[model samples]
Target: MALVELPYNQLVQWVIARGKTPEDCNKRLIAVEELCKGFFEKHTSIPQDVKDMQRHVHCEYTEWYEILCDITERLKSTEDGKKVNFIGQYSYEPLYDADKILRAFRKNNLHIVSYSQVLQKQMTFNLPFIKKGIESNNKELSDYKARRAESLRKLNANINELQNRLKVYCMDIKDYPFNEDFEVCLKTRLTQEIAIKNANMTIHNYHRTLKLVEALDNEVVPVFKAFVKYQKMDKNYHPEETMKHIRQAVKHGLEYATNGNEDTEERPSDDANAEPEEEPLIQIVKDDNELLVAEDKRRIIFSTQLGQSSFRQLLLGELLELLSFVKVRIDELQNRSNAANYIFSQSGENVNELIMQPISKYEKYIEVINEVIEILSGTDSMKALSILKNRSDLEKSAQGEISIWKRCCKEVAEQSDLDKRIQVTTETLKRFTSDLESARKTIKDTKAKLEKATAEVMGSPVKIFGEIDNI
Candidate 1:
């Protein structure tokens, strides 16, 4: 049977199976059936009105169609073959008309092709994608929303369980954690301390370097320039001119030292007394990680005096200290890795309780949430999420406990694998170490130049930047 002859439902199913939406399939099917019915009625009806068509007593009303088909076939087989339009100066060379019948019908105003062809282009058609029996786009989207809601439901529950566990531990946990039950907890706690310290030291050193750089520009060189000007010594010597260039170089260097990036804006403050500020959020940014992951100790150091900075040095002094801080952090993480390895190896075949035991019920709890985020992975539901945000200090309070468990767990259910994290951290540390001695020579040269200028002005050489007790 012809495709147009199929039942209405069958046609809809066929169209739908070819990736058309159910709504589209049903609408297009109704129109196709109407067009096909009209076409059959005209093609099969007796010719009653047109005198030319009525005179053809050849057994059918549409006899002109068969005659045209015959004419088209004979023309193609003979020298009626497609030829260039020599009438147009042969401008269409090699692009001769392929269908003589189509143009012939158009020229004579006699078109009786497939009836469906007239309105077919008005509708949209799609190729096959998913299998048949799938629901419409609206239904599928609704299902996704339900699944996403369920996932969030589970996510909140798991986060709640994590909060409860941490609360219980914090309320009852000993300061030293002398109990064997807390041995694992103790190690994670230590890891938190180390990370926070490392972060503080990095910021402290960075700011100190900025201060020293600023001192060179604001205090040291300005004082030297004044002394040179007061002495009226430009006639014989022009060391002040050299100092002016140094002042300019220091101004540019200050930008790099403060922000740790190319931007000239001031660095984000890490001081305890500074007003709290939030990182600006994009309206459409909605990654599961934005609210899910706990803040590590490194990020926490900015608000506390855990890493305080108060020192002076040459232009690159902050760069040197930052590198030094990274070295210490790497050493600490390496030690923690070794400790983790030892904890794993201590039990032999029986296995250590500290290594094999569940850190808390939160592990299994988070397991349920693992698939929830994925359900919403392709969704924008997170844009309106405030489950974590609405609570009072929940995000901040959970940071310590959540961060500790992360360091303790070798395999977090939905997070990055522990081994991979260690490998990446180690590789990064190696890169920093390779360039450790970079500014040593530059600082040495800068100090010699400064000492000579100061001695000529004040009889005694002054150490302008490094290890000086006074500003």
Candidate 2:
């Protein structure tokens, strides 16, 4: 049976209707079925759609394929052609029109072509040209490498020659001994010659020469002096004269004079049976025995002096320590005082209102007393004496009452109890007005006691005591 070609629209409708309904409803169903069967058979046997799509896709692909193949073939056919071979292989120049190719394929409903197949086709055309180019490049690269290697070898030879020359120069210089003056001079002259020969001699070379000279002065000179001294001492005869000779030699080298000519005086021969002259009393007094006794006395005196000096130093150290502690305490107290003063000043007529809840007058006094006690406890006897002296000076100062008033006022401001504050303030003001009459009396009593103690210690009256007692 011959197959008739149905339009896609009609075929789709017929297939849809056949799927939706039974054949008995329409008499044309049988004819439609018979036509459909023949149509399917022809379609399966010779798919015109598929063949058309293939033809369109193949045509489009062939254009690109032909161009790449032509370029590759042309490149491979020439001597310098391989350098351009990648134009066919990896190049995507043709694919620049990918959108057009895609549209054409879609218009024909063509099957999609693979990226690998496109690349393979490109490489197939490109390989021959690339191989030719690679061969030519490899030959040129080999020639260049050979030339580079030759140049490197020549450079290495020149470096080796220079190194050999340097080694010879070093050996020649090393042969000159530093101990021999002549060799040293020769080396010095050689160095000068080298420096003169070099037009670009640097400050660094001068510094190196100075360093060498310093080394000779520090190490070589001392060793040479010691060696000469040792040789002089090593001679068998004249043991006493040896020392004299060594001293003279050292003096000559150092450019100094000997102490005296006492060593040069002649002594009597050992075989002479002569009695020694009797020394005078003055001579006896100035003899080594007397000198030794005097030296012993001087040593005892020096030891006693050192002990007294050390005692004085110890006293000074203690005073310094006491002063430092007092200074710190005074600073702390002054800060608290200033703070209290500030609060009082700011309160202004309402000084009672400027109360700090946590801090109290008694507590502040305790703190101050504790600080004073710490300082007093840390102080040595010498510091106590120094403090007593300072207190004497402070007693003489007219500002003492003012200082006490200020301290008392600070204490008053810190008080929490109003009654106690008023009482303490009144008492403090009274004491200030009285200029510490009781404290002065107590200090007078202390002065008497200190005088008595000093008299007992020294077994004599101390003149300062009379002055303090009068105070």
Question: Which one wins on lDDT?
Answer: 1
* lDDT agreement with native, every candidate: 0.34, 0.32
Report the error of model 1 at residue 218, Å: 3.3
For candidate 2, write residues 1-471 as lDDT tens digits.
223233222322332353422323233332332332233234342323322322333332232222323333443444433332444532222222222333332232221122112323333433334444545545554554555455455545544443353343242423433223434344333332222222112112222222333433332233233433444643553423423322332222112122332222232232211221221112112222221112322222122211122432432343343334334434544568656444333333432332332334324433443432333233432332232224332223313322333333333333323445445545555544344353345345443443343334334553222222332
Name the TM-score of candidate 1: 0.20
**Worst 10-residue lDDT window, candidate 1:** 124-133
- All candidates' TM-scores? 0.20, 0.16
Error of 1 at 192 (Å): 1.0
Superposed Cα deviation of residue 7, candidate 2 (Å):
38
